[model samples]
Target chain A: MATILKVEGLWKNFGGLTAVSDYFLELPEGEIYGLIGPNGAGKTTVFNLISGVLKPSKGRILFQGIDITWFRPDQIAALGLTRTFQNLRLFPSLTVEMNLRIAYHTHARSGFLAALLSTPSFFREEKEIGQKVDRILELFEMSDFREEIASSLPYGWQRKLDIARALVCEPQVLLLDEPSAGMNTKEAEDLAVLIRRIHEEFRLTMMVVEHRMPFVMGLASRIQVLDYGSVIAFGTPEEIRNNQKVIEAYLGVGDLIA
Target chain B: MKQGIRAEWYFLLGGLLLFGGAFLATQFLNRYLLYILVLMGIYSIATVSLNLTNGYAGLFSLGHAAFMAIGAYTSTLLTFPLALREAYELPMLPAFLGGPNFVWPFFPAICMGGVLASVAALLIGAPVLRLRGHYLSVASLGFVVIVTTLAKTMKGLTRGPMGISAIPSYTNIYWTYLWLLITVYVIWRIVNSRFGRAMMALREDETAAQVLGVYPMKYKLMSFVVGAFFAGVAGGLYAHFTKAIRPFEFSFFLTFQIVVMLILGGMGTTAGPIVGAVSLLTLRYALKPLEEHLKIYGLIEIIYAVLLIVVMLFKPEGLVGQKRGVKKITVGGKSSA
Candidate 1:
């Protein structure tokens, strides 16, 4: 399979502290890759770097063979890579439909003049965006909440809306930061199934940074364990589950590594 | 979609009828009332454009008065009569401009002013727009200071702040009303479109919007340039209506007043600034007679302060956008539950 996203020698520093050190990944096309680490193990930091939110102190990243290490976040997203935040980051005051439509910015071709004139082409593009938003809302089962303000939604729905917003952009590589962070076990299991369905439907390469072992383990085809800003093991879910170093890394933290 | 298109046509017809009504009123109304109406129209344009920048884009600019000054001066210089240009000892006109005995028409002069102001906005906004919040505000305020200082010291062009008078009185009620309609229509269209959505998204959360593929710099500069263009046109109208031009006329105080109008009317709503401008201008005119009778110099200013404070306390989101707020949250809450 073709490598869809590749990171090499990725390093992030905050003053004297190293948040991420020599992090690397070679995610193949259409693969669901898992990234698991303890709290502050630089998992989200890696996601940030990959998504162009944070510039790496020293490293390079390639998306579909295009170097994007120095690209701005918006530019990276326009290049067909998108991410969802661990903390929900919806446009709080806007409606759910508006939120999804806004994410279609990359796909829109109409300019200010077209919009000002209300040209037929502009209407066509807007109709296309509306259809996509409707489809995503239906898939997520949030069509009833289309006009609801994003911040006013229940917590779980907001989380679903965040994923929906990212999905609306139709990205080739999706970086999900803790998709099931605050959900119960059953909810996490449901989220895993939903994510798997999404992966199959969209045929997207995903790098999910999740804390819940069962959630990521069940969804991702391969798991990469991280500790202290570096990778400790990389293998299939079963192999990483039994890796001695990964087990020891989670030993003191009492994480479920079995 | 067809229904939406028909409704928009109806809106256009309504706007044209209102313009016709205003035109008739201008013929019969006394000079004082007409002057007040024209002034209100000019302020409406300025406030609406400012709303596009500071309200929708969330770029707190305090330099829009500088843009007005650029427009005022550009239009004034272009439309200045050849006879008066020689008499006032104005600096030589650039060769690219028409020669002696050639005076540019009013429409092109005003449009040229807007274009120049847009250029200036692009130049300054390219770098300064990257800064967010208070930094952007302060930088824009500094732009006002620079423009004012240049107007004061550029003796050859601005006559060293002695000011220019007897400018051609081409700005009648029709001209003012037409420009006001254009500004309102254009801004309304922009705010209802994709560009407007990108702006609101950026305003709510820059990071989220960025990761969603909304280029912040492009939209920020777009709003700034567009807002500056209308402000320039408004300045041109003010110059022609007043038949005078001066550097201090487009000062920080003018910017403050426009900002107040935007905040009081409702920042993001399309009709908010227009309502704010009309109400505020009417209040100023209504209080003028009382102030003269009581011999109180600053009574109007004091009242304005009190009114703004009361509005802020009661309607922090401004007056126009409040109706949806009270009902939507409850609906959202119940539905979510």
Candidate 2:
């Protein structure tokens, strides 16, 4: 598979504290890559840097072989790189449908003047956006909550809506920040199945920043373990499971064989 | 089905009530009451327009009064041939502006004023809308100060601190209500549209808004310009109603009064600004005698400031906030219990 995203020599610092240090990764197109780390391991920070939320102090990020290190968040999003926040950042006042509609704004061609005049083309585009929103909501099984305000949705549904919104952007590479952080075991299992289904259905490349061992091991074809803002291990799940260093990192033992 | 009575219907009904009340007051009340009502109606437009920015879009702009000044001066200069005759000692204004004897009708002049103000807003909003939060507030405040200074300094055009007087008294209760209805309709339609949804989205989370393809700068400028247009219409009516125009009339205090009305009623709600304007104006008129007796220059200001502080402390969401409707769900032949 062709590489969809490439990050090399990435460094981000927050006033003498290195958040992500010399991080390097290559994500193949249409693959689910898992990023695992303990708390404060810079996994989410790496996602932030790649998604253009935080600028890297020193690095090169290429999306589809085009350098996007300096692109703004919106610009990067327009180039089909979208991410969900660790803490849900849904628009509370807007309905679930409206929240998803916002992601289609890039696809909308109507200007303010056109909308004011109620032009036929504007109406057509609006109808198209409505249909697109319906499709995404149905895909996530969130159609019943379409008119409900995002904040009013239950916790699991809120996470589903967030991912649904990100999907509306039609991104090539989706960065999910802890997709099942707050779910129960059953919900986590369901999410794992859903993630695999979504990756296949959308033909998407995904980098999931997660700490849940079961979910990551079950879902990810390849795993990259981050320690102290650096990639300590990169291998398949079986190889990673057998790595002595990986075992020590998780179990805090110097001599452990899996 | 009963929930079909959307918020827009409330706005329309409320506007009708205001119109009916304005008409009734004109028939039974004295000229002073009529004057106050007219002023209230005009200020209501400004307050409502300001709410579109400060309330719905979550932008705080202190320079709205500058747009009012622009409309007032533009209409005054265009219509008041007396100024052309006295200040420039010329018989007429430009031919396109109807010249010396060209007295365009009041409605068109008001519209012209609104258009002019919108144009000015577009110019200023382009650069100012780039600044967010406190920066936007400071930039807009600076704009107001600049416009006020220009009005005072440009003596030949604006008649300086003396102001322009002898404007035609063409605005009456009927015309005021008509304009108010139009303003209310325009604002109501805007807030219910997709653009309004995007604006609220921007207010909630700008980064998410941008990622979703809602350009914050463009929408912010659009709201600013539209809001300025209505504010200009209000200014035009004020100019014609008083048969006089002055720079100080659209001062920082005027901006503050409008802001108070918006906050008091509820910022984002369509009825909030109108409710705020009518309530505060009535209270001010009622307290005028007491204010004179106490020798306080701005008794209303003290009241307004205190009210704002109290409201911010206890009910920062205001009287009418953006509330979500509850939904009932059913699953497996029973309510999801």
List the DockQ of the predictions in order.
0.45, 0.26
| Model 1 lDDT per residue over B139-237, tens place | 999999999899889988887687878789999888888898889888877877889989999998999999999989999999999999999999998
Task: Quote the chain B TM-score of every prediction.
Answer: 0.94, 0.88
Candidate 2 structure quality by residue, lDDT tens digits, B16-67: 8877887789789999988898888888889988988888788899888998
The TM-scores of all predictions, comma-separated, are 0.95, 0.85
Report the Cα interface RMSD of each model, rounded to 1 decimal.
Answer: 5.3, 7.8
Off by over 4 Å in 2: A13-18, A119-127, A248-258, B1-30, B82-84, B87-112, B119-127, B289-297, B322-337
Q: Would you list the clashing residue pairs of candidate 2?
A: none
Winning model by TM-score: 1
For each candidate in turn, give its C-alpha RMSD to the true structure in angstroms.
3.1, 5.3
lDDT of 1 by residue, A1-258 (tens): 999999999999999999999999999999999999777788889999999999999999999999999999999999999999887788888889989989999999998898888888888888888889989998899999988888777667777899999999999999998888677677678788888989999998999988888888888889998898999899999999888888788776456535
Worst 10 residues of 1 chain A by lDDT: A249-258
Model 2 fnat value? 0.35
